[model samples]
Target: MRERNVVSAQTQLLSTVAPSQSPSFDPDLGVITPPSNGMARSAFARPVAPRARWRRRYLACLVLIDFVTALGASRTVVALLDEADAGFWDQRVLGGAVSAFALVTNLVVPLMWMTVLVAAGAYDRRALGRGTEELKRVARANVAMAATVSFLALGFKKDLSRATVAAIILTLLLYTLVTRALARVVLRRIRRVSQRASQKVLLVGRLSDAMAVHEVVTRNPGAGLRPIAIHLPHHPRPGERVTAPVPVYVGWDLVPLVQQLGADTIAVCGPASLESYELRKLAWQLEGTGLDLVVVPQVTDVTGPRIHVRPIEGLPLLNVEEPTISGLSLLVKSMLDRVTALVGLVLLSPLLVGIAVAIKLTDPGPVMFRQTRIGHEGRAFKVWKFRTMYTDAEQRLEALRHRNESDGLLFKIKDDPRVTPIGRHLRGLSLDELPQLINVLKGEMSLVGPRPLPTEDDDYRGDVRRRLLVRPGITGLWQISGRSDLTWEDAVRLDLHYVDNWSLVYDLGILWRTASVVLARRGAY
Candidate 1:
């Protein structure tokens, strides 16, 4: 009788709410407020989702940053040119056009740049604060701005200086990228701390699928998804226990449940019980609720660049492109690797010589250590590094094998007795691996790829052998991620991921991150 009354009251409350009108909740008063125009009260109105709020805030921040960056860049360029040329601003180009040009540079340019960025979708919520898409858009927008300026200058016969145009564009691009990156760092830190700053996700699916999604969102807090609850399609059997980190619910009536739990995002993962028609109906139910529905596809590991969505009739088809292991891009990567390796070696020769001298003076062993390691396509090559271990290190390997702190084929010891005092410092700073730049120059290795393993650890087979498809590297995803601290499985996974997603841009990002990791000495022995 009590349950029926409760249901009746809920039904009456919902019936009173108009289809188009959403009720507003007062958290302090714990009641739903009617529309300001004196409309009927609603029980279904929810506050704006935290995810949406944060996204709006972030987007506004980006717009402000872009505008400020563009303005600053323009002003800086104008100031520098004026100072350098002495009469740069005063000079008449095309009959006393100095004032007009000044107006364009000071006011018109920043607005035009912002317009280009908006049209390029740099400030789109989906692109903002995630991935390289935002950065790429900003770069393209700058290019477009440059082209537009050149076209206007040519068409109107305006005496626009190419140097000034290039300077403004370059400055804007650099400033925007740096400011956006710093903004992302700050936003990520905030999201990591404040649960309300992230999307409150309600997971709906089979237990296993839900758990998988849960693990992913939990692992990446920067994704800004906080799982609030799990909703199963069916109830557990008698005496059966269902264990979950979040609160669990069972039923088809998800609207009320979602509102009650304050979940703004519904993630449907591997919907076994929810068929096509039912899923469509769920979408209909959520139409005016201001809630976001995210469907998790089974496909994994592939990134956005590789995946293309094609819609035929109403069915969406996913087309996955083959990894770019070879071709023009790989050729470019190879060229870059060799060129960078050459430059690095030339610049660091003094430091390298100093390390070599120090090792010889203290360790009483050969300065350079070479080991037979597997390289690209199972080719055996002698990997070079500054010797970090004593001359008798090989002999003591068997005795220390039992004390190996690493998992899988790799052998590592945090406090190995074989490492000389100077060697330990060199290893900690990753200076010992500097000589591999020689291998990179020789085409035997890459500046960024899988770490080359010694002959004894060569157990490549199946998908694992894919790591050998590319030249090994001095530093890679594995090195920057955790190095010796990562488990063998994790190391192999990272290596394979790098191999599968190899790109010049990805390599550059890893190289950039590697500097910070090395400086921190994280996971290094």
Candidate 2:
């Protein structure tokens, strides 16, 4: 399919060529070309020197710091070993003096660790300023290096001290990760304050597609993709600027535009609907230019691990792995949820008792509120929470239905009349939901999953119901992003995204973000 499209584009380009010679036209391909070297030099408005230099300098400094950190960790390990009792674990490893072993481990091992990091592509420019991926690679590289070294020592029958080797490897891994994290923080700060550190991006797509990408990049400054302008292939009005979230340009004379904006990257979205051949030709034209080309697929909210590309013949096929429904991973998730919930209930028993007493005193009603809610696999369960409303709150719900401010099947208001004063405080702090830990212990809920809906709400069907495949949670993406504040569509989108991409690491990250959001009390009511 891609090859045919490319061939079709080539055929179409032949018909558009001018009869006479033109500077921007390629005679062999019969296609319009980018600006010639002399024209680009004359028309180029922005210079790329400063930004390129800043990027290179930052990468170099980061690599140097990481290597230095490895050395420091190695030295500390050696110092600790030197101080240990002589008879206590053989100071005579390698059949030599402690100083001799120290020299080799401190110098040689640190160098090997640094080499491993470089070989792992930790210093690649594409990875710079990116989050988590780089750190993950750093840790992986250290682990691989440790395993290789340990294996070699055992195979060669070398008299290496296991205690010293283990200590040094552990220290090196810890030191490298801490230093890289700190470095990322400083570099991200610099990227925000220094224009030269940010990568200028030129988006090519429809207004809506470009705007979507623009919003994501703007929201995540750490991504470092600063949108300077957008190019609309099918501009409604030629030679007229369209005011989008950013400046939108028309027509396909992209080389001069790229030069003018000094863009470091050109991000093309699929919605532009360019022929495969045209995109290939554009990439060819950009070969000599320093701009990096990034293709943004139309598929949204998919994680990197699930999306795979397989090139067959001349076409690239995207294969999206189905989300895991039942596996060892699910078992791990269940175990963690139950263990954490049990421990939390025990630890917070005193606080829970106090909350129960307060609720009973204030409302003179049930301390616990029980309501039927949907759970995994569409199972109905009685969800538990500390009662936050009056005894007759359910009866008055129909009268207050017209006051619903929350969108979708969920009904909520900023200041619901049913909520008692104590209830309002508890809701604000999310303390009212603490009793749901019992649900997690009972295996009716998870620590992190989609929000369970009330049994009365039957608005979900089709893909939306897939959220039921996993155990519902007390808090999830919906809670961390915005609870009642998010629109119905956005809330479902986030929940579905989590359903498809949930992993142990991903869950941990969400949990960390959840902590901060809970404290800030943003969008809680």
Each prediction's whole-model lDDT (CA): 0.81, 0.78
Residue-wise C-alpha lDDT for candidate 2, range 1-525, written one tens digit per residue: 543443454345334434342334332332233323334322334333225777888888887887788789877876786677655327465456767666665677777887888888888888876767888888889888888888888899887778877888888888888888788778777766774477889888877788788887786566677887677777364343334544445554666667655677888976554678778876776765667888998888898589999999988898899877689999999999999999999999999999999998888889999999989888899988999999999999999988999777688899899999999899988999999999999999998999888845365687788788789998898899888888888799889999988888888878987887888888877
- Name the lDDT of candidate 1: 0.81
Best by lDDT: 1
Clashing pairs in 2: none
Q: Please report how far candidate 2 places residue 151 from its true position, in Å.
A: 6.4
Q: How well is each residue in 1-525 modelled by candidate 1, as lDDT tens digits? A: 543443344334444555665544322222233344443224454334434677787888888888889889999998998789987766756469878777887779989999999889898766777758879998899999998899988999988778888899999999999998899878778887775467789898987899899987886687778997777776666655556666555643566557656678888988484788778877777767878888888876667578899999988888888888999998998999899999999999999999999998886769999999999999999989999998999999999988999877789999999999999999999999999999999999998999998754358867789889899998999998789999988898889888878888898899998998999999989
Which consecutive 10 residues in model 2 have the weakest lDDT in total?
26-35
Error of 2 at 101 (Å): 5.0
Q: TM per model?
A: 0.84, 0.81
